[model samples]
Target chain A: MRSSAADRTRPTPLDGLVVLAVLAAAAAIFYFFRPVSGNFLTARIVLDNELVAELPLSDLTEPVTLEVPGVRYPITVEGENGRVRVLHSDCPSQDCVHTGWVSRSGGQIVCLPNRLVITVTGGAAEADAVTG
Target chain B: MTHSVRRLTRCAVLTALALAISVCEGLVPLSVLIPLPGLRLGLANLVTVYALCRLSGRDALGILVSRCLLGAVVGGNLTALAFSLSGGLLALGTMWLLLRVPGLSLFGVCIAGAAAHNTGQILAAMGVLASPAIAIYLAPLLAASVLTGAVTGAASILLVRRVPFDEGKP
Candidate 1:
């Protein structure tokens, strides 16, 4: 009798355990790396590894649009109360535009083609709670 | 000498198959729905899993490398080669190590491989973009890996069961 590949055992208990462990670890990482919710959030716009603008969202009396310097494609960005997002971009991918809004600390919207990165960093409020 | 030649031929075919699957997967507008950077079903890994189970780890690694290189060209840029290589190597390494464990199934190995692959891509992205803050994106990515890995694992298991590589014959 010739043997076929079906002889392998069904999913063992160990496989289920491994899957659970992977999921748990992922959840824990998501929790650990989660953006902190603070009273004040600052949106930092970086272009090609340089800081182009930093908007203090808390103190922002009105929403502002940013002008990125020396970018190959035109990208429109808007920042308002504790959040920021790309409104539009001439870049073909539209990856940054699709990122929508980022309001929490450590959140980011990246445009790889244009090398534009918008990140939200919260200050003071959640630091002690998050770290300690 | 003939045996080595036969093995090389098999691995080359395997690499081509993997490349084809990856190319087909890319054709789907999955990115439009998910809108997540670098997320995919990772169907190409099925070939790697099948090769690893039936063939040697060396063969699997060879296929993975060649497929990534070719896939990058098919992708229309060299920058993608970095992501594919980083992810493919790490995913293959994780699956290879896991195969040594007792009583583990394709499910565990493939799922773990997927997670490692995503992590490797993010690490490469951080390096290329010089942005550490993007690390937060790993969370959803890791979660997505489990689902994608499960799909890949289940499909490979079927391939392993049904497809006869005809290893031994009278």
Candidate 2:
């Protein structure tokens, strides 16, 4: 029937209010940074922190498989219109494969073990260079 | 039981419980269910909070380190050990500081700790990847932390209210 010191220090509603404020701020940040549709016509593939390939999504007449050195499996990048995706990968987690099509600026899919990253970039000159 | 022996027993029992919770939570595949990488309920943290409030800070830290090391070993992931250790230590430090604040309760302390944990893990990821773009994951991680931290914090508060852990007080 004895109460501990922890029990004596009761949490006020202010504690809940503070947590709610934090959650709201985090949600707001996430909303503002959410992927947006833009001139994202190219997908840049970086392997081992180096730029491996930059494929124009608009010009893909057929899918292309890129086998970067030092990685266990090849990555198949497929695109149509303005969207791109990793159709296949040999990475164990398959997180990149699960990411599916990314058609907007700021979208990214990372294969950590393979040190591979696929990201969409939006720019007129870069898109033109890749498409041309 | 004698006083010192009783304290040791309590620490052992709490450490084992925390480890069990950590290992069991690892098996749930929360990431697959939620489709979010590095997301977890952090159920074992309840024990850490309980210890921090009821027992000594040293006891809480001991339980936390034991849980992280044993959990990683049982989960069979050496890479995860780095992340967990960095995050766990950061969270523990943050909780220790926040618990001293005047108006803040365990709920606030836990929420801050969770946020700190996420930040530390992201920093570790950035280091391992050699890229700062991983910071983009922070918002989502923070949002997830709010939910999971609240659950664990509230649970700990309820537990501390009901359970008499004063016997092990140092």
Top lDDT hit: 1
Per-model TM-score versus the true fold:
0.73, 0.69
Q: Fraction of reference contacts reproduced per prediction?
A: 0.43, 0.36
User: On residues A1-132, what C-alpha lDDT tens digit does candidate 2 reach at each position?
Assistant: 221324544665657776786677677767775656555467888888888778776566676545555676766666666777778888788888877777777778788768888888775556654421
Q: Candidate 2 clashing pairs?
A: none
Cα lDDT of model 2 by residue, B30-147, tens digit: 7876777788888877887788887778998988888888877788887888898888888888887777766676677778778878878888887876555566687888888888
Residue A44, model 2: lDDT of: 84
Candidate 1 lDDT tens digits, B30-112: 67788788889998889888888888788999999999888877788788899999999999999888877777778777888
**lDDT by residue (tens digit), candidate 1, A1-132:** 121222354676777887787778778877777767677787778888888777777666688787676888998888877788999899999989877888888789999889989888886643221110
Give each candidate's interface RMSD in Å: 4.9, 5.1
Q: What docking class should model 2 receive?
A: acceptable
Q: Candidate 2, A109: how far from true, in Å?
A: 14
